[model samples]
Target: MDEIRAKKENKEYDWYVLFVKVGYENKVISQLQSYFNKKMILPFLPKLEIFHKYSNGYIEMEYKILFPGYVFVESNLNEMKFISMIKEFIHYYDAPLKLLKYGDSYEFAMREHEKSMLQSFCNIDFCIEASTGLIKGNKTIVLKGPLKGRESIIKKIDRSRRKAVINIDIMGKCVPITVGLDIPIKLP
Candidate 1:
């Protein structure tokens, strides 16, 4: 019981942001998991479930990366240890990895508030489903899911492509996240 209490009291991990090759986010995650103990590190790539339309009355569900080239990781290890682990992993793959940086000196770490916000938005599965929204009088109204109450974060909505481009601040830098939306179905 005391051990459990101690563990709860000492939450040592912070969410760190990593920038990888645009299409290599999943590959990097797989490599990290294979190299490190899965319990010691948690990597996340926010994905969206999109419905692709096809001719002859066919629709297919597909998963798309929400933020291309960016991945978030949570770990209890200290910064030096984490960096060392990443360096070792890169050495094995012969691919370069970079942590988000501020100017030239410091690594940009995600703020607690930002982390919590992302957690709430992504939930435990780390995947956001396509939301259904309607455009009325030049305003977009989300009808369901996490995007409903957080409409303000959306910078632009692409109706034809059914994608919402949201602006989020990470470590004082504004980054854009693109999420898919289901085409609005007309109510009968």
Candidate 2:
């Protein structure tokens, strides 16, 4: 079974957000994977597909980070020693780490709604797929992708750019996330 699936079946870990240096997301993820077991620490960096237009009507597809400089980590916070070890390791690499806080506790975690939303974007292989939507008489309809049926959370939609922006509250701050989508289907 895959690591995420196994972790879901066990239900022993809680999701936490780690703030790292910009452009170092991949490096930190690699280091974390090497130092910890899949169950002990699972790092997730959600990505989306974007298209770059060329001069000759040729468009190139590329993957971009959905949330830059932040990585979601799943682990059991009860394991204080393990948490400390991770902190030390991150510090050793000269990467500053900030654990999200809720109220006065350091154990602030992702809400069920947020977790479900994120999980919907990820396939069984743990890859995040780009979402799709349609335009129907001034209304946006998500067709067959992760963003489907979750329109309530969408804050804005840039039809020209084919992107949807959603605001999520994380660690007491509202973070705006921009997700790329394919050209919308216009309904008659």
Candidate 3:
């Protein structure tokens, strides 16, 4: 348990992203957790809590994957072995486990800064909890949570849905991610 956490914090380990079926992010993480040693692989799927309204007219909170079809893992294992493990999973599930590649090399891993930004957004449990903030005029001020001090990245806010859309760099591409934002108050 702590061994994995320690290794993740180590600089030698690299972060890699795997593209799987959209709905299988959690399943793939679970399978990887069982197949690999905890210290060798730290699989994570960033999730966020959102409010859902049921047919009974009641609202409940639920967790949703922040980036569908992608799972990030920090590992110090050999690239060949990691590819083989992904191949094994592809064979077993009959679903593709495609590792994101850069340039012509399949071993290309995410840069340290990219990984650091992600780590800052997600907590130890790999979840981005709702950010509490206030809206005044045309500005959004995040008082707490992962989005604090990161208001510049916010492109739009939907108060009804309690979601904020922001763009972040992933695999050298700008990807828009929706995160939970609670604006409990508004000021003139």
Error of 1 at 7 (Å): 6.5
Q: In model 1, which runs have C-alpha deviations exceeding 4 angstroms?
A: 1-12, 183-188
Residue 138 CA displacement from its true place in model 2, Å: 2.0
**For candidate 3, what is the TM-score?**
0.85
Candidate 2 on 46-108: residue-level lDDT in tens? 676665567786766777777789887877545566567667776677667676656686555
Global lDDT scores for all candidate models: 0.72, 0.71, 0.81
Q: Which residue pairs come into collision in candidate 2?
A: none
Q: Measured by TM-score, how close is model 2 to the native structure?
A: 0.80
Greater lDDT among 1 and 2 belongs to 1
Residues forming the 10-long window of minimal summed lDDT in candidate 2: 1-10
lDDT of 3 by residue, 12-111 (tens): 7777898998988888888888888787888888788766667786766788888889998877777777777766766777567788977586545887
RMSD from true fold, candidate 2: 2.7
Candidate 1 residue pairs that clash: none
Measured by lDDT, the strongest candidate is 3
Task: Please tell me which model should have the higher lDDT, number 1 or number 3.
Answer: 3
Q: By summed lDDT, which 10 consecutive residues of candidate 1 come out lowest?
A: 1-10
